[model samples]
Target: MIYAVGDIHGYADQLDRALALIEADGGPDAEIVFLGDFVDRGPDSKGVLDRLVRGQAESRNWRFVLGNHDRMFLRFVTEGQQHDDRIKSGLSWMNPRLGGTTTLRSYGVGGPDSPAFQPPRGKVVETLVSWWTNQGNLSDQEVIIAAREAVPDAHLNFLATLPLWHETDDLLFVHAGIRPGIPLEEQEEDDLIWIRDGWLEDDRDHGKLVVHGHTALDTPEHHGNRVNLDGGAGYGNRLVPAAFDAGEVFTLWPEGRRPLVPA
Candidate 1:
């Protein structure tokens, strides 16, 4: 059996519980597919990433899909690009609406709002940039440099290499839903990681059973068309790790496995 986990959103404690449930219930032969959004919003973004990285390395069963938040993290530390409109050149994912600030804090890099977020001037002024571009992307050198410096080289490397999707003969796993009516092979990157417009509204088939987590829901929903495992774990809700086999789906709750029905 293969287990598909929902969006973790930086809740490392919850992610651990969910994993414990999976290990106890699914056992030695089970493989895992993580639906992404493993960072941001909630507490312990670094912890969440650290755990997943270690888990994946120790066990060969783990698979991961890229989420938009994960992309933002990569952009700040790896690509040095701020794609959000709220972002200025060197803000380092400063916009809190997507919980970038929280994620930054977890890595020991305070947000722009924090007094220590950036120093007016110092040794670290330019030692950590993409090329050590002490030339902060922002007019304010101090603020732009901490986010990159605070994160470790290993974590940045891990974020830079996450896969966009994972597929099996019976199931297709991704961070977000797929575009309806379009073949999976031809779907665009934006649609795979960010599209929600017609992808969620349309009831048309997506060729394969796509298991995803991006659109948050209070409970995990199985729509027959697709399975949504996002339970808003970053927003004080449960972090779900679901088990899928044959044509059935079940969430690994504290009490044990419970059936998850189609939406």
Candidate 2:
């Protein structure tokens, strides 16, 4: 059986749990595909990248697809550039809800006493929001420089080399759902990592069962045409790992395996 894991979003503890469950279900050498978003949001993006990079180095039976957040992190550290207008104009990636600041802290970019590290509450929230109103500005240049210095070359290389999708005979794995009616090979990168509206709502088949995790759900959802395992790990929810065989999908939980029938 092949295993597919959802977006990890920097929660190393939860990631470890998901890995352990995958190992138990299919041994250490199980063929596994990771739906990305390996960085940002949670406290240990650095830690998550550390483990993922080490696993790749050790020749673990694993593959990864890039997610939007992962791309944002890479762009910020590599070029001090930010994607998505919402982030560029708002609190940027460091917005409390998006949690880029937490990832920066994991890399030692900001200390506990730095204003960037202050909890977003009351006046602090107002101050931070006002301060970060325009990202990619001189005000945050130091943080960007520190992040670029703190992040390792190896991790950056790994992120740079990640593929947008992985596929087998019967299943296709990607960070986000593909654009329906478009050939898999022809799908755009943005649709692969950032799409939701048209792709998520469309029920049309796309030749293979698409396994993805961009949109967080409280539980894994089986929509006949695809399986979503995101489970909101970036939002303090579970990082569910799924095992697929013979067109059947089962979530690998600590307690045991649970079948996810198509909705």
Candidate 3:
């Protein structure tokens, strides 16, 4: 069986529980695929990256799919800037909602979480200059230098190596759902990692069961055509791991596997 974990989002403790459940169901040699967004939101992005990098060193059978947040993080750490418009408008990754601040905190660089760095919500902008003035400011250079020193090169390499999607005969795993009707190989990178509309609502088949985790839901959803495993672990909900074999999906529980039927 192939085991797949949803977005971890820096919650190393939840990841531990999910891994324990996967081990209980499939043992140590199980092929585990991680749908990404491994960093941000919670307390221990550093820890989560450490474990994944170590696992790769051990030559474990694991696969990682890149998520949008991971891309933003890589950009910030390597280039000292983020490409997202929110960064300029002030709701940066360090914004509590995005959790980049928490990730930086895990690396021992403090102060990103201070209220002074977060943009005030609901504030009206009179003009473009005022809008610029209202923007939350955080120093990317300070965080980048400290992060470069504290975060192991191996971890950054691991994130760099993640693919947009991993496919098997019966299942296709990705960070977010694929664009409907587009060939998997031809799909755009942004759509693969950041898409929500068009992909999530369409029930049409995309040649294989698309298993993904970008849009967090209250529970795992099986729509007969796809499976969503992102159970909001990034938002403090449970990180439910899953197992797949012969085109069937099962949620891994401590007792064993439970068949996940379409909701």
Candidate 4:
């Protein structure tokens, strides 16, 4: 059987529970795929990555597709570009406007007790240096520390190496929605990562059971064409996972929520 999970934006405890459910149903033999957006906007981006890497290493059947957040992370590594800057200069302006400042504040920076709110130094540096180094590869302690010192350059290369998408006979996975009318190969990464209304509102098939999580919707909405599994887990919404196998489709929500059958 194959189990595909939705976006897990740094919710380690919730992810642990979901994995436990996966194992309880079937252990290492079960194929597991994570839909992506495994980091950011949560308290423990580092922990989420650590668990995923560890899980994949321990289980040969595990797979992870890159989410838009993951792509942004890769851009940091490959292009030596800031996440928002790579999206558009408009994103840079939108960051502060769209709760970036509030998110930073929630992290205990730039708030009442904030030590120094230095611009240009960037949140990516702060998050990587403080959180990421604490998680993976004890042998690479020195390397990670050195990378943190270099900031934009070293970090960018590390993120660029992640896989952007994955698929199986019954399911298609990505960080964001795909273009409704375009062939999958012809679809642009930007559209896959950033699109919302146009792709979701349209009623057309993209030739796969597209499973994604970037939209941050409150419920796991099915537009009858694709299933959006984001559920905004780290943003105080429920962490959700969708399982698919031949002749059976089920969903698991975090405690205190009800699961829904696909319409």
In terms of lDDT, which candidate is stronger, 3 or 4? 3
Q: Rate the local accuracy (lDDT) of all candidates.
A: 0.76, 0.83, 0.80, 0.59
Off by over 4 Å in 4: 77-80, 83-158, 253-259
- How far off is residue 1 in model 4, in Å? 3.0
Winning model by lDDT = 2
Q: Which residue pairs in candidate 2 have backbone atoms (N, alpha carbon, C) closer than 3 angstroms, thus clashing?
A: none
For candidate 4, the TM-score is 0.71
In terms of TM-score, which candidate is strongest? 2
lDDT of 3 at 224: 85
Off by over 4 Å in 2: 85-91, 112-138
- List where candidate 3 sits over 4 angstroms from the true fold: 83-90, 112-140
Model 1: lowest-lDDT 10 consecutive positions? 124-133
Model 4: per-residue Cα lDDT at residue 148: 45
For residues 80-103, could you state the per-residue lDDT of candidate 3 as single tens digits?
653454233445555556776688
Q: Per-residue lDDT for 102-146 in model 4, tens only?
A: 322322333222122224454432221122222332222332333
In model 4, what are the clashing residue pairs, if there are any? 74-159, 74-160, 76-156, 77-156, 77-157, 78-156
Q: Tens-digit lDDT track for model 1 on 1-263?
A: 79988889889899888888888997855688988888888879999989888877787688888888888887766655545432233334544556776787788655335222342374222122221113333332453467667788778777778888999988999988787877778887777887778878777677778899889999899888798899888789988889986789998877888898875
The deviation in Å at residue 61 for candidate 1 is: 0.9
**Clash pairs (backbone) in predicted model 1:** 126-134, 222-262, 222-263, 223-263
Sort by lDDT, top down from the best: 2, 3, 1, 4
Q: Using Cα atoms with residue i matched to residue i, what is each candidate's TM-score against the true structure?
A: 0.84, 0.88, 0.88, 0.71
**Winner of 2 and 3 under TM-score:** 2
Provide the clashing-pair count of each candidate structure. 4, 0, 0, 6
